[model samples]
Target: MAVLALDPHIAPPAIVLQVADRERPAAGGGRLLPSGFLSTSGSQIVDAGGRSVRIASIGWNGTDSPPGAVLAGLWQVSYRTVLDAIVAGGFNTVRIPWTDAGLDVPLNGYNDRLGWIHTSLNWDLVADPAPDANGRYRYVTTLQLFEKVVSYAGQIGLKVIFDHHTNEGTEQKNGLWFDLGPGSAGRDGGVKGRVTAETFKQNWVRIARTFAGNPTVIGFDLHNEPNGEKGLITWGGGGPTDIKAMCETVGAAIQSVNRDALIICPGPFFYAPPPAASGMDPGFATPSGNLTAAGTNPVKLPIANKLVYTVHEYPDEVSDIARFDLAQSGAAYVDRMNRGWGYLVRDNIAPVWIGEMGSSLRTQADRDWAATLIGYMSGDYGNQGGPTFGPGQQPISGSWWLIGPSNDPPYGIQTEWGIGNFRSEQRDITDRMLMR
Candidate 1:
């Protein structure tokens, strides 16, 4: 791979938000009553007057690694280029994915005096206890890079959501998530492994505590995409992993440390399935007899008010949108979401956000599907009473397109798979909808 530029640019001015205790207007009510700064064992958010901000955001894993690409140095000059483009395109938030282990080198772009930078540079070359020894456990680079990114986004009015793509390893299948334990079940299972479950709660605590006071951090995603047989069931138990239960556990961990930050938890199948056990994977449900062990226990945590259910709608197999040529009409697009997209977000009461969407799909059919899906979720989801935690309760709070070097020309600048085409095109579409 070619080495891109890696020179630290001077940091921009930071936003100085007033911290106070005041009641902000709710979506549609008298208002959420006044309260003090949101506090937790790990950290605190909210101003002295009690106004909390939600992260209406986007996801970009650049400045890090792609499935088949080499690791880019954190200070790579393109990091700034990509970030500048994203901000210029009008996105005010970014979900940064980093390996759980840590980074081995120092990012050299900003003035070395940034607080997050100085505090995060420990020079520890270990991926122990959690990520093992492979390059996966490294959070050193993630810590430095994300802090800078988050700080920068704050300067530009964007929020930040930190996500852990995997623990550590050389290769991954289809760019999935980290499982809890060992073997195929844990590695490529996409949060199906025990290692994930084992370490997740603690991870939340650490992360929540780190950004406790910064409202610019929208929240933390416990895990990316929960999948596989051993993965989370809707409940908690030995039967399999229970995403609902995982939410409770991880949510509590975050709440324990910083009660004010929001918690965004993706549904099973990465938002690919509905509540019905039929469309869902057998493993995601508890074992036939372990009903009690399933994660059915009610979640009674304080952060429940701030909980947001996350799911994705990519156009791979199973998406009804892909079955027909959707590039044709508005009605077809609406129909696809009503059938497939609607099913995913309608069941939950908490706000629903399309955490990940956009495909490297290659066809007019695919592109049409993308346009419709993006339109439906960002526009229609709000029209329909999907789920929302904040005042408006809009079902589709946010959406982002996946990007990589794979997105080269021709289709360039218009689609995620074709590079240049997607950035400009997605930005145009997104800007029209979001107005950021």
Candidate 2:
């Protein structure tokens, strides 16, 4: 019962009409997921059959670019090949990030941006071309490209989570989720100049409706890293600017369209002092401004048994490895997780996913930190190689930061895209996560 979000500016494809007419898999070759619908049940994501499911996931970060440009182009691979490699690497879930501008704008309007890439890059390398009726242009609209990718993901037995990574096509520096004007500093000017909260809600409503009843399309990651200096990040009671209120508004809207939709709410960013260089208290410092903290008066969304809380962790940005060295012990890292999003899971309030966390593993310290963190997440404290966090409660699940095939790797899992080859760091992290 998935609905198609067709751009009004373009002629409707026959495939879209076919999708709109069917209650089951449409004739466009997209298949239904075997695992069925996923819902949350007491800190665990349960499948339609009521079995607990842990997300062993990887992020595909292509939508960070302008409309119609995907990361697969950068690697000279097709979206299918990229996803095939992900499944081959033992990942069951893929987090695909997208910009609001890319999703909202019509295909015809994005021709110039697509043209620049078409001229700049080797055209033969681009994949998933949505040529015109007569096969004149080989470019695909952003929505069409996404649809193909999600269809392929389902065909390969991989779950997909659509992440709204940025409001604009450029880097996601604007802290606020809504009220972003065109030509705003740090945003690549295109499409609508002003993005209102209502627009954001409408966009998500369209998304939820489009993907509704598609079991493989799991959830909506509301926003990526709600951090900025404009005070857009608040847990509750900050008025309309509050993250909690926004999630409630948007989550309710999505649920209104599809009640089974799982809503992922990311924790707000706050500065934390580096752990003590040397002292009895060598643990990581407590973050000062976390909105997810129990003390912050967190709000409970209207959606029942479908809320998944998330927190992003980076070795340098979120946690200072130099100050809180993993070599010392896992106590500091464990304590830090407990105070942050972990408390939600510990208190049986909600399921918390370490939505994003990774590093280059360039140095021995970086390697140690990664190992220790993975070990801790897998309930193996201090790299003891055994579950020690508790009996039934560990952080519910986690997804690696990225799945790129960068030559000079910082946080990529593979060394080459579409080759299905994984770096040692990727192997170590995935292996540890599977233990849970």
Candidate 3:
């Protein structure tokens, strides 16, 4: 593994060092230190004044309709509508979920999918086999759209985190090469497995090569939710070798090409703690629970010395049936936090950003659960050093980007399902998270 040197032109702002002293009363008598920047064993980010504000980012998944529709007149709103909402809602950053398919796929030509209209088209295709009536090559459309999205966000004062959501299929479901399953060209545990190391390197190389020198882009997430496969085997470490290699390969790729952005690697299954090496049986654990077992690779692999470990937390997953069953009341919900998220944080060997977490108002119970979870995120749960890793602090940065148009239906589904037509609320989440 190789470490990257910071470009002299883009040297990070000088970091302020806050020393830990046991004698100072202002330090909360060694309980909690003041709200000043402190040095850690990793990279540093500072403001213009050389102060590190606890990065309180607001993020959301940014994919839905095609870039053409977004730039064109889909729902009669520009991509800026979402960014504008973010600024209005007090946010400063955005995580734009982009797929490589738009670039990699061979397009035949540039024909408007919708009725003939003249407007801005955000997506571009690579023109592999030459453009046909359908449109340009997938890769070309992707690149054009990415540039536009990043440029637009930068113009509006929002930092952009380019997330490569899918490598093979669309960004909606089990499309990554790894999730292809049995008899597929890119099945799990195979050389082309979705989370395998080789695929990680290849995809990232293409991505890093493309985005080199772009300043607005913040970081790269190696893989998302790298678990939940039956009869699947990991690399030499018995954990997700592909996912870990992704951190190294993608980190190195970005560093080799563009060395300014941070590198983020997520834990398995929405950041759930992996099970023991023996693996968690189906009857013993839920679909979202860790399968790698308790003593497996806790931190997968570090991102070549400069990066942040991202973890996702949700009430639906992580917690066992006993805890969730009792979550009817606020007290039980807090208990679930301790047993679920708390354990993972303590045991996991990385500082984390709760990458994705949100709930909807489908039912009164659901709303109550969501609200309670939000309160915990806002710092209400007392520190409980129980179970595996012991007490730990909640992620200081994350996304509350999901907002539903109706109480029953979740909004921002576009980011997950829609290939090009991303919803405004989804983009709004990105704007908020990228806030400085």
- CA RMSD of all predictions: 10.2, 8.8, 12.0
Q: Alpha carbon lDDT of residue 425, candidate 2?
A: 61
The global C-alpha lDDT for each of the candidates, from Candidate 1 onward, is 0.44, 0.59, 0.42
Models ranked on lDDT: 2, 1, 3
Q: Give residue 129's error in model 2 in angstroms.
A: 9.1
Q: Tens digits of per-residue lDDT for model 2 on 237-301?
A: 54655677778889998998877767988766545332232111222333322434433354456
List candidate 2 segments past 4 Å from native: 1-34, 73-75, 104-138, 181-193, 228-230, 272-291, 294-298, 317-330, 382-395, 407-409
Name the runs in model 1 displaced over 4 angstroms.
Answer: 1-56, 62-81, 103-140, 169-196, 229-240, 270-300, 317-348, 360-362, 378-395, 403-405, 408-424
Pairs with steric clashes in candidate 2 = 182-193, 360-410
The model with the greatest lDDT is: 2
Give the least accurate 10-residue stretch of model 3, judged by summed lDDT: 14-23
lDDT by residue (tens digit), candidate 3, 211-270: 666655666765555443432323224344334444555576667766655677654442
Residue 303 of model 2, lDDT score? 67
**lDDT assessment of candidate 3:** 0.42
Best of the candidates, TM-score: 2
TM-score to true structure, per model: 0.61, 0.75, 0.61
